[model samples]
Target: MRISELKKKGLESLKGKWGKAVSLMLLLFLINVILPYIVEVIGSGGFVQWFDQEGTPLWSDIFGTVLSIVLIPLTIATTWFYLDLVRKGNPEITEVFAIYKDGKTSLKLIGGSILQAIFIFLWSLLLIIPGIIKSIAYSQLFFLLRDHPQYTILEAITESRKRMNGLKWKYFLMNLSFIGWGFLCLFTVGIGLLWLIPYIGTTLAAFYDELIVLQEDEQPIEG
Candidate 1:
């Protein structure tokens, strides 16, 4: 699908659902952003004190890192929620925490996320461009895992890399297409992200759906 069509599909899916979508995004912001900020403030005593110290408390930084790692499943859950919204048009808010209900799935998501991060970091050590390319290549890992329960974490990572072949530039362009909206959001003091986040998420889900169709079409027919 063309990037325009994918974005159009995302907007269509979001019709009559903007409120719910924004609410979900707000919940994520609370967990991923606000909660961490709160932890940092408490750990450092206050912004004034933190400035006097000249750096964040070591324990605060460590806690933030550990919290992010522990919340990896939440990221996958967000992907799942958007996929469901695009595919079924009625994604439940609870879907944001669905992965946590399945211990094994949660573990797999966390492990895959860590592995992908390490690989991207290693590539980044070589150069920024290679890191960006590798990050795009692994972008579909969560979606693949959601759709293919049988795939081990490594298998899903491998499949994401394989399927992204020849499509990295297109995917990069698709993300670049959001730059205009991003700048506009800055004008809103980031408030517009409540809507923009869901728009981007649904569009990504649409992109994954297109990839699945393309993959199916490429399969050789049995005699």
Candidate 2:
């Protein structure tokens, strides 16, 4: 589907669902923003020094790893929640925290994230363009992981690459359409992101839904 169509339908999906969406957004703040900010404050303000004379580097790595683990699944969970919101029109705000309830799934998410990061970094070492392309190629990893939880991380990564073949540029444009909204969020001093994040999430989910349907349609007819 085209970018305009995705935006129109995505807005329609979110029209009466702002409350739930914003709630999900706030949960995201706890996951993505507040936790890291608190970590940084503690590290920079000598809070960790009471325990150790030299803790800054250790604290940095600790928080960095913690945030990576938290962020990877939280991101997938956000997309999963929004995908549900698109498909069924509603999902519980607690859905965002569902990852914590399943330890195995959370581990797999962490593993997948580390693998993707390593691959992207290695590719980036070769050239910027290849890194960008690989990043987009793996863009569907989280969605597929959520939808097909039975799939291994490698399976999801492979399938995402296959599914995104020839469509990454279109997907990139769909994301580009949100640049204006993102900048507007900056003007509001990041408060606007409480709204814009979910807006983009729902729209991206809708776009994924469209891709699913398109893929199904292109499949060979059964006798």
Stretches of candidate 2 exceeding 4 Å from the true structure = 39-57, 216-223
Model 1 agreement with the true structure over 47-158: per-residue lDDT tens digits: 7776678666788888889988878898778877888878865877887777788998888888888899999999999999999999998898899888778787777777
Instruction: List per-prediction Cα lDDT, in the order shown.
Output: 0.85, 0.79
RMSD of each: 3.4, 4.2
Q: List the residue pairs that clash in candidate 2.
A: none
Q: lDDT of candidate 2 vs native? A: 0.79
- Per-residue lDDT of candidate 2, residues 1-223 (tens digit): 6788877777788878889888778877786767775677676765555355444467767877777776777777778888887786577777777778998898898899889889899999999999999999988788877777878888878878878888899888888888998888889999998888887887888888888536634432221
TM-score of 2: 0.84
